[model samples]
Target chain A: MSDTARDRILERLRNAPRQEAPRPDAPASTAADPDRGARVGRLKSLLEAMRTEVHVLPAAEWIPRLREVLQARAIKTLLYAPETGLGAALAEARQQDAAGLPELVAYSETVESFKERIFAVDAAVTTAAGAVADTGALILRPTRAEPRLMSLVPPVHIAVLAAEAIHPSLSEAMQDGRWSADMPTNLLLISGPSKTADIELTLAFGVHGPKELIVFILDD
Target chain B: MANEPFENNVDRALADAQLRKNFAFAMGNFILKRRAVFSDAEQTERLRTIGHAIKQRALSRLPELLEQLEAACTRNGIRVHWAETTAVGNRIVLEIIESHAAARVVKGKSMVSEEMHLNAFLANHGIEAIETDLGEFIIQLNGETPSHIIVPAIHKNKAQIAQIFHEKVAGAPYTEEVAELNAIARNTLRRKFYEAGIGLSGVNFAVAETGTLCLVENEGNGRMCTTVPPVHIAVMGLEKVVERLEDLPPLLRLLTGSATGQLVTTYVNLITSPRREGEKDGPQEVHLVILDNGRSRIYQDPQLRQTLQCVRCGTCLNHCPVYTRIGGHAYGFVYPGPIGKILTPQVEGLEKAGTLAFASSLCGACEEVCPVKIPIPALLRRLRDESYSSAPESSVPGRGCKQNWAERLAWKGWAFLNTHPRLNRLTTALLGLVGDYLPPAGPLERWMRYRSEPKFAPRSLHRRIREEGIADE
Candidate 1:
């Protein structure tokens, strides 16, 4: 019956004499110099306008600076997936700071076992696959190592990205990288903190996703 | 309710001072926010033009593109279904959940599902479908139809929401604080997200080129609906599909900018398929249901088909003078405002929704802000023409007192008298004497109900010009 319905609907469409409107050519992504500080400045300004906290630092300050934010916010029991390289670096950073900072928790073998912990964790940190400079959005491709929840379920999301990974637009990011070749199961473009103005047209933050999206732009 | 006749709804809406205040406040902010997003006029225009072209091309080649979409989705291991009517769509959804024997389903805001009334159908078959979007959740709790497309609970203020939450949800307290109200909803829905076996979402843009379903949202409940559950189902109108992935950028850019006046929403999920091999999470089973309730009939007409270009931004509602004045509830349909005036008649029988055509002031505010540039006022006029035509089969709604023989004869009589100069002069002289004294009970009274009709002059402009030989001067 579903097949018959499909056939009938498609047939109606097929029988209608096609009035083919011309397909549009997508605008080419503007190439920007990867080393340009102007791109970061623009990205930061845009991100801040969208209510994201953009932190710029020398390569050495990356981990230490993150520790400072976590300590200042009094975030206890930070979660990270140990298998990821960023997770490993985070572990080293924790050992270096080694006191008055949050306790570090790694992903248990499965997201199911630690589901309760994930909901209760103060914050989660992950490595951003890349970002778009025009929209000031972080493009995340979730794998088991840095699962979807790390950036989503937690109240605070700390994503560290190298400066060169910032593309000028979604079009540029699509063309420059092999990101689209084998697309991940779930791909996300997060522009700012989870927010809503649904209540009396009043803008409120931290509706269901992260309240704070603090980005660490490494100058590596 | 959509089932109600429009005039009664309007009367009720007009009397409710609160509804008017809500619409005025919401529309004012919506207008300001939309303007703020498009501060760069050049960039906005470029994106709007591209968005218009993308919709035009996809709709023009709808059959081939839909076929490509199904094929691509099949290749990507997602199930796809088609529904000729809302009833059929509801049945399909029920079947999918029944196969899994899923007891409960969490749903994101999908106007298509609302059109189908899937929740009532599922409840009859003993499945609870909980709405996850906070606005939708509130509406669901109160057992009401959505008054607006984008903001389902726009009619309700924070205090009302808090009151509803207190009464409906278990062990909940009432607080007028918007943030606290939001927090309560978040905490309440979080459990449902984890427990539900099936999740439902609306498709923002279904890219035929890649078989990807792009979802745009700010509150993140859409993510929860599509992500937390083991089985995910997406429902959309057939016209929602775009031909290529590249078409998405401009459409999305304009959609967010126009809707809430944001360059991009908080989250844009590009879902290619269910969770792949060795993946930690996401829905295991993904289904896409394409519904063609009455859109194909609209598509057959070249002019009326442009109405399908609406991206559901609610910008039209914000800018429309009539919509802002009467509020969405006056439209008496799921979709309200200018787009609703054009769409309701087609989706419902023209007789049922024909009166909606008159709801618009024909101000054309809707067309100006439409990212896809659908000529809404023109379509309303077209529908009005169809409604008044003598041919019932060819007309929408098929019945109208406005177009009845008495009304036709009155106009015909007036035209005939005006065309004959001698009769025109005699009638004018008689009407100037008596037009002011016409009884308070008939056609003249009806005309005077809203505003006083200006009395005609004792002498005609034509006669004075001729008598004075003004033409020669």
Candidate 2:
């Protein structure tokens, strides 16, 4: 049934008279900024405007900052992917934590195995593929280790972005990463925490996804 | 109410002062926000032009692009389904759900699904289809469709929404506070996301190059719906396909900036496939349902094809005076406002939706604010013509269904009188003598309802010209 429907639809589309609109001229190109600091500044302001808490720190201090923020927010259970480099570092940090750090829960198994536990998790930590300064968006290419829901599902999402990886815009980030050529199974450009202005156009945060998004910009 | 006369719906909507106030307040904010983001007129126009071109380019190669999109998605292990009608689309979705023995569906914001009336279809089949988008969830609870595209429940104020939540939701307290309402919904639907057998979403942009289904949403519900469930099914109008991944940025920029004046939506998800091996999360199976749903017929006409270029931004509705006054419900369809005026008639047939074309004041505000430059006013004018045209060449479905002999004869007589110089002159002279004394009655009654009857000149222009020794030519 679907095959016949498909064939008929395609045939109808093919048989339809072609509508010729004026061919669009190439888009006006904004000059890519050569300065990295400008990109970082733009990303910070944009993210801050959208109510994302952004902390730029030396690589050596991100762990301490993450620990402090988690403690401040009273987060108890932290979810982390077990295989990624950042996850390994977080595991190492948890091993050496004196006190006040949240309980580190490694997502070592399939989500079905720990769905309830993960939903009850206070926070989740993951590494960003890159960042777009124009929109203050974190580009996440979820992989086997850093699964899609690590940055979602939890009440809070703490993503680690390298300062050197921030690009001028989404187009620049896509081009720099050559994403189109070898795209990941899932790629997301998340600008802020889950938000909605649906009810009477009033803004509300953390409707379904993580209410709080904390981005640690590693300056190392 | 979908079959109600357009004028009747408008009258009912106008009578509701609260609905009018809600629309005015909401549209005012939207208009201001859009203006602030696109402050630079030149830059905004350039972006609109690029966005327009990309849509046009993609549409020009639509058939090939759809094929490429199918192949690309298939290569990525994403199943692609085609449906010529909404019924077929609904059946395809049902089959997918029943295959997995899943009866619960958590749906993200999808206008196409609404057009399919998928929720009702699923309900009839004894399946639970829950709306996850905050706005959509509210309206679904009230047994109503979306009043606005971006903001589905824009017609309801906070008080009304609080009442709906308090009444419909079990153990939910009445709260007019936005944050509390959001939290209530979050706690309510969050579990549904994890428990649902299937997650359904509308595709914003279906990229052909990388075979990606892009979804833009502010709330995490969309991400949750596409990620948490084991099976993810996305439905899109066939025209949603873009030729390349690079075409996304400008279009995304225009869409967000124009839709709600956001620099970017909170989440822009690009799903190329379902969960990969060893992945701990994300949907295991991904299905993309491509629905034509009268779009192919609309594409047959060169001029009318512009309708497909819409990106579902409600800026046109925000700028439309008629829409602001009447709200979206007055249009009585899944889509409402200026875009709906043209789209519904064409899709549902002129016989059913022809009155929508005449609902517009033709102020051209819709076209001016349109991100893709879809000449909405011009399209509305064309639909109006198609409604009256008994011509065989008319492509719109149910064309000439509205052609009444009395109206046609009146127009024809007027045209005849104007075409002949002597007849026109005599009519004008006769009108000069009695036009001032003519009562505000008959066809002119509606026109004079809002204003006093106009006083005619003592002499006709041609006669005055001759008396003043001016050339009559």
Candidate 3:
């Protein structure tokens, strides 16, 4: 009585009159557009429309540039995963710029113990696994080293995306292996800051996730 | 609330002027937003066709896909359960929570849970289910059902929300500022996210091949609910499954483009399972509850199966003039607008929800803007047909059981009169004797008088002209 529902449902579906639609063409992960450069430009404008501040810079200048950005914003503390490449660069920068421009906190402890402190942090930076140019979305494939909360809990989120990893469409990103069989437990695509229009249809940002989403696109 | 009939609900909703205005304004914005993103008409048509095909295929292959999804999810360490009815679905959810000994649960927006009244069930069983979505949270506090699918509290303006906050929310001051009100909810729910022991969410699309649950949301609460808790449970209708992971792209494109006019929602979480060995923060245990309720019955009829193609985009609601005029709660069920006009009777028993069939204007606006092209007006007509259909209940037969006497007689009279042109003209001429355009006597007559052309002009102009020999000029 408690569990026969599954069998009953399956049985019903099994007996449903068969109507099959032709399978869709295999997904193409890369943008079908002839002008790849224009897609990136279009992506930038779209992201900007969503109120996300976008920066397109070369790989060599990413760390120095991020340092300039952090100092410019006057963010008191920055949280990052030490295992990531960007995390290592930040660690080196923090040691060199040790005049308390921005305190760098390494997320080495378990989240359960440091949950409160994690919330109090001003900003967190993570490296995006891939991005969709059409939607201007950055994909965060959460791993143990760079946990899911880093991009989610903080008020400000700064993500670094490889220019080459940007796909023409979401379908292309998935078909091209950004989201595969052996993918992480959770894969997140962030289009902009957390927002809601529930209060009288007036749009307001930063309800639960980051208030500001700053993406650094590195053209290597 | 669920048991109230549609007629009663519609009357009450129509009497509320503020609710009508909110629906008109919000639905108008939604229309413009959805249209803006699909500027390329040809591409939009291509996607609509693809979306329709994908849904058709999924519904046709539902049994196989459900099995594959269950098997794949189990392999990925996610537990799977099923419920044939809303009550069973609630009981199953309670049983899962009972096992966890969880007290407080945080939930993202799940219309299926609303369908099951799972929050009420959980409360009855001594567990609290908190809706983290701001719109849902407001409706929950107000002790009202959601008025709109996308904007649940669309019926309330800032002043009303501010008043609710002042009265209900702890330490909240009376402020009609939208930003401040959002902040109050954010601060209040932020604490709940960390304290809640379990989280529940709805699935946007469940992939069969990889056994993933895809969710689209603009706010981060979905992320909080799925990730922050130790235990996570997801509930979805059986029709929400898709065959392949790649099939998601086109469906998602259509869904988001039609929903809020975004290229994509702010957040699209693809969850495969609970936390693995190395994951630092995520649910330790995950569960997926697949519900049947009455969806299987809908699938039995191939024509009606198209109703299941809805991606819950709410575009049809935005485009539906009738829905915009009267607003959501008037439909008197979990879903509202054109889709609800058809779906309510199908799921809740056509006999129980039969009046919903009459709620539509039979306008094709919903069908026209439907990303998946569900023949909504036709389906509504089918339900209307079922309501008045004289077929007796048979276990082997279809959805509705009741027969409407007046409707049957009216159709009979229409058939008889239309077949005999002499009688039809005689009756028309006799009615025309009531002074060409007499004042409408009643609601039915008022509508009839306006819709019908004035009795055939005394004599045809062609005959008069030919007789007078002025036709050549």
Candidate 4:
């Protein structure tokens, strides 16, 4: 039934008198040299305003910081992807932990098998593909190793970001990453923890997705 | 509510003090937030211009771009469906659900579905469709349609929501705390996400270059609905398609900033396909349903084509004086505010919905804040003229619906007098003599409902200028 509907709709659109409105030139190219320092500060303040926790640390200190974040929050189980480098390190760290860190669970199987377990985990840690400075967002391209639900289903989402991955704007991030040519099955730009101001315009966080978003900005 | 007269709806809404208070507070906050984000006038103007251009470009070649989008989506393993009207759109969705043998469906916020009245359609077929957005959930529980596009339950205060949740959700306790209310919704909806056989959402932008459906949302329910369920179906107005991925950044910025004053929403999900091989999660089947409804007819006219350029930012609603006072319910449509005034009459026909065009004060606030520069006030004026026009060339549905002999004759007489300078002058002089004694009744009564009648001066402005020896030029 809709085959004809498609043809009919497209036909109508084509037959319609064409509008001769001028097409605008491409948006002005962003500045060639974006001040990375100012962007980082803006990103930090923006995230903080949304109640997301941001920690700046040397590259080698993220693991320790991650442990502290888990301990401080008293997370019982931490979901991770064992295929990623950070995930392997987390596994190794969990193995050596005599101080009783959160139990590590690998999301290695299909969601059909891991759905209940992933949902029950206290927190999940994922590596952000990149970050947008202007909007203070963390971009995640869900690969086979780290699926789309990791950052969403868990109560707390802890993302690790290298300082260099931050872009001045979303346009720059898309252009620099060549997103248009090679797109992922699912891409996410998450700015803050899940929130809503629906009822009487009263702001509330952690409505459905992660209640807490903690970013570890690794300054290399 | 859908069948009620627009004026009666407005009267009832105005009479409700609580509704008035809710709208005032929410609109004020929305204005402040939008102003804060777009504080730099030059930058904001550039962005709006670029946004408007992008929409126009896409619309100028809407047919080719839609074909490109369909081809790209097909290559990505996502099935595409087209519907000329809402009935077909709803039927397509139902068939998809039946194919999955799904009885329970969880939905994210999609105004397109609201336009279809999809929930009611599904319920009639014995399919339970649950709304997962917090605002949507509250309104769904109360058996109400969304009052605002962005905030579906903006018409209801927290107390009213507490009452609805208490009465609707099983074993739920009444609480006015916003946090507690949100927690209740989260707890109730998460299980539905995990268990529902199908998930449905609305597309914010469909990229022709990449076949990606982008959803901008503050809540993660959008992510959850598109991810957790085994099958995901997305519905969009065909006009939401963009020609390229780069078109998204500016449009997204304008939409969020203008709608809620956010620099970026909490999540902007770009879905190109279902879960790929080796993926552990995400929906395995993704379907995109594009509904034309009355948009194709609307696109036939060059002037009305600009209406298709809207990004559904809802900023116009926040800034509209009429919307602030009467709220969304008074509009009696899927959309409300200035956009609705011009859009509804076109889609539903002027005969039934033409009165909405008269609801606006033509303040131009809506156009000033429109992200895509839709020229809403101009469109409103156009719709008003269409309602009264007897021109055969007017293509609008139910054109000249409001035309009557009384109004036509009055306008004709006024035109004739204005064309004859001597007679117009005589009439003015006579009005200056007796206008003050004219009764403040009849048609003037409605005009003076909230205003005082102006007393005409004994001398006309033209006479005063001549007596003062002012040059005619």
TM-score of chain A of each: 0.92, 0.93, 0.89, 0.94
Go through the candidates in order and give each one's DockQ: 0.65, 0.79, 0.73, 0.84
Greater TM-score among 2 and 3 belongs to 2
Q: Pick the candidate with the highest lDDT.
A: 4
Q: Give the per-residue lDDT of model 3 (tens digit) for A1-220.
A: 2247788888877777788777766534444563657666877788888899888888887777777777778889999999988888778876876654478788877777878888889999999998888777888898889988999999999999888888888777886884656757999888889999888778899999999999888875
Chain B alone vs. reference chain B, TM-score for every model: 0.94, 0.97, 0.90, 0.97
Among residues 3 or more apart in sequence or in different chains, the pairs in candidate 1 whose N, CA or C atoms overlap within 3 Å are B350-B397, B351-B397
How high is each candidate's TM-score?
A: 0.94, 0.97, 0.92, 0.97
| Model 4 quality (TM-score) | 0.97
Candidate 3 deviant stretches above 4 angstroms: A1-3, A26-36, A99-101, B1-5, B391-473
Better of 3 and 4 by lDDT: 4
Candidate 3 — which pairs collide?
Answer: A29-A172
Rank by TM-score (best first): 2, 4, 1, 3
How well is each residue in B1-473 modelled by candidate 1, as lDDT tens digits?
A: 66777777788888888888998899899899899989878777777788889999999989888899999888888899999999999998999998998999999889989889899999999999998887888889999878778888888888888899899988888888888888888888888887789999999999888888999999888888888778999999999999877677788888998888887899999898987777777788999999999888778777888888889988998898888778777787778888888898888866778888877778788888899999998999888888777665443445343577877898899999989989998988887778777777877677688777767777777777777767655
lDDT tens per residue, model 3, B1-473: 45676657767877888888888888899899888999989878888888888887788788999999999999999999988899988998999899989999999999999999999999999999999999999989899888888889988888889999999998999999988999999999999998888999999999998999999999899999998888999999888999988888888889999988888889999999898987778899999999988888788888888889888988898898888887877777889888887888888777677677777778799998898899999988888777656555321133445565765688799999879978876766566566476665664585675387455555445446656867467
lDDT of 2 by residue, B1-473 (tens): 78788778988989999999999999999999999999999999989989999999888888989999999999999999999999999999999999999989999999999999999999999999999999999999999999999999999999999999999999999999999999999999988987998999999999999999999999989988898889999999999999889889999999999999998999999999888877778888999999999999898888999999999988999999999999988888989999999999999999998889988779999999899999998999999999878889767999988889889899999999989999999989888899988877787898898678887887987788788876565
Candidate 4 structure quality by residue, lDDT tens digits, A66-157: 87888899999999999998899888887887354688889999999889998899999999998998788999988888888899999999
Q: List, residue by residue over A182-204, the lDDT tens digit for candidate 1.
A: 66777899888888877787888
The predicted structure with the larger lDDT, 2 or 3, is 2
